[model samples]
Target: MIIMWKNDITKEIEKKRLKIRKDEDLFETVEEVFDTRTLMALYRIINKGIISEMRGVVKSGKESRVYWAKDKNDNDIAVKIYLTSSMEFRKSIFQYIQGDPRFKVVKDYRKMIYTWAQKEYKNLQIAYEVNVSVPKPIYVYENILVMEFIGENGVPAPLLKDLSVINIELFNQIIDAIKKLYNKAKIIHADLSEYNIMVRNNKIYIIDFGQAVTIEHPMSYEFLLRDIKNIVRFFRKNGIDVPDDEVIIKWIKEV
Candidate 1:
């Protein structure tokens, strides 16, 4: 009976994959790297009606690629797929996983990558709940995470690093966002910097929460200080006089 149930489930997943293939073309640029399991995950997401048409790649990174997609309702969404085959990615992600209490230490590399994707989703949810400006998470299964698209008409918003003008008001807004993310959400964006912030209509939206850790993480304070320092350095270079990193960190941690 158990073997029969397993076969039934396998047939359902294959049916979904066939339906997805008939509906749209996906993973054009990423075709070489996407294994059968990854393709199945995408099919599952489509079967759930989270995404309808999977479009072109918006951004590609060493460990993941962000795809522009449309949901069943025709709303734009960003689909992030973590590459399961990168050995370096596996090694690099260990530090963030080591001290976190939420996840148990999984030995399998693929499972670890899935956990990393889930971590980002959970972190985004925490920030969203506290009114922090982040991409609204829609769904996550295995290595694929679907979220609100940060741009319009298939173009992404400009990264803070790419912007030529850096206004003082905008600088303060980012600082306030950092404070809220810390004090309210209790998550430190360990990898925060100009590169991870998107500027849309003069508003700041934080992205890339895969490395963020809760306040209880062992390296949380250090990570927080590093985040503050990175932002402060960028603003100072742009001629926006900001408070010292230590002062900013103190303010963030203060009730």
Candidate 2:
């Protein structure tokens, strides 16, 4: 019975695989990312009607790639797929997972990558629930995460680091986001920085929460301080008058 069940599941996955292959352009783009397992995971997501069509790559890095996609309703969404074969990514994220109480350290590389994707999804959900300015998480399956797109058409919002003109208001808004993320959501964005922050229409949206840890983590305070320092350093470099990192950390911890 178990063997029969396994075969049935395989047949279903193969059916989805064929459906995905019908879109040659999307199949070609997906081929650039990884192997059959990743494709199968994406197929499962498509089978659920969460994604209608996969579009062009918006961002690519050693760890993951973000692709613009459309949902069944024809609305844009972001699909983030973590690279299962990136040893560098595995090494870099190990520290974040080590001290995080919510996730246990896994020995299998592929499973670790999946956990990393789930971590980001959960973190985004927690932040979004608290009204923190973050992308709304839609679904997570294996190494793939689907979320609300933060831009129009196929163009993404400019990162804070890429912007030429940043004002004090932006800095203050970011600080407020950090405080809310800390005090309300109880999640510390361990990898917070200008590069992961998106600015659109004078509003700031924090991105990339895979490395964020809850306040109960052993190194949460250390990570929190580092996040404060990164924001302060960036705003100060842009000629915005900002309080010292220490002072800002104190203020965030209050309440």
Candidate 3:
């Protein structure tokens, strides 16, 4: 009976896989990463009417893959799926998870990945609610997260690192976002850099919040300082005049 149930699930996923394979961009990724469990989680999200269709891969990384998808209204959305089999991901996320007060660390590796996805969704929710420039989180289940897509069609916005022109206004906007995130949300974006910031039509959106932590974390200050340094370094390198890291940190922490 158990074997029959498992086969049924596999057959269902295979049917969906055939449909997804029609998109050449998503075909390789679906085959590469969509294990039975991950596919099941995604299937559940689709069944819930949150995701109407899965399109192409927008971003691929060691820990997760972001796909360009559409909602029931045909609006573009991003689907981030964390790789459950990534042992290295477990080690890298431990520091942030250990210090975060919101979550309890789990020994089960798959469970930890789910926690990480949930953490990112919660962090995005907190930041968005505080009016910080971030992807508006829609839903999260197991290792999958659904959010507003920051780009048009299937193409993602240019990263800050890819931009040719940098101006003080852009720099100030990011700093203000950081300040809002720190003061209003009371969370630190532990990993902030040019690579994770998206620029589109003069607007900026910060992405990837899996490692963010609350201000109550033991290493929160250090993480905050690091985030500040990263932004300052990137702006300064682009010939934009920015304040010292210490000055920015002081301002962000101020009420």
Q: Mark the regions of model 3 whose C-alpha exceeds 4 Å error after superposition.
A: 1-29
Q: Using alpha carbons, what is the TM-score of model 1?
A: 0.90
Winner by lDDT: 2
Candidate 2 has its poorest 10 consecutive residues by lDDT at 19-28
State the displacement of the C-alpha of residue 118, model 3, in Å, after optimal TM-score superposition. Answer: 0.3
Structural similarity to truth (TM-score) of each candidate: 0.90, 0.91, 0.89
TM-score between model 2 and native: 0.91
lDDT per residue (tens digit) for residues 1-255 in model 1: 355588889998999999767654675544667898999999899889999888889998998989999999899999999999887898889999888899887998899999999999999999999998999999999999999999998899999999988998878888888899889998899999999999999999999999899889999988988898899999999888888988887888787
lDDT by residue (31-133, candidate 2, tens digit) is 6667789988898898899998899899998999999999999999999999988979978988888888889999888888899999999999999999999
Query: What's the lDDT for candidate 3?
Result: 0.89
Per-residue lDDT for 162-206 in model 3, tens only?
998889888888899989988999998989999889998989999
Q: State residue 207's C-alpha deviation in candidate 2, in Å.
A: 0.5
What lDDT does each candidate get? 0.90, 0.91, 0.89
Question: How does candidate 2 score on lDDT?
Answer: 0.91
Error of 1 at 199 (Å): 0.7
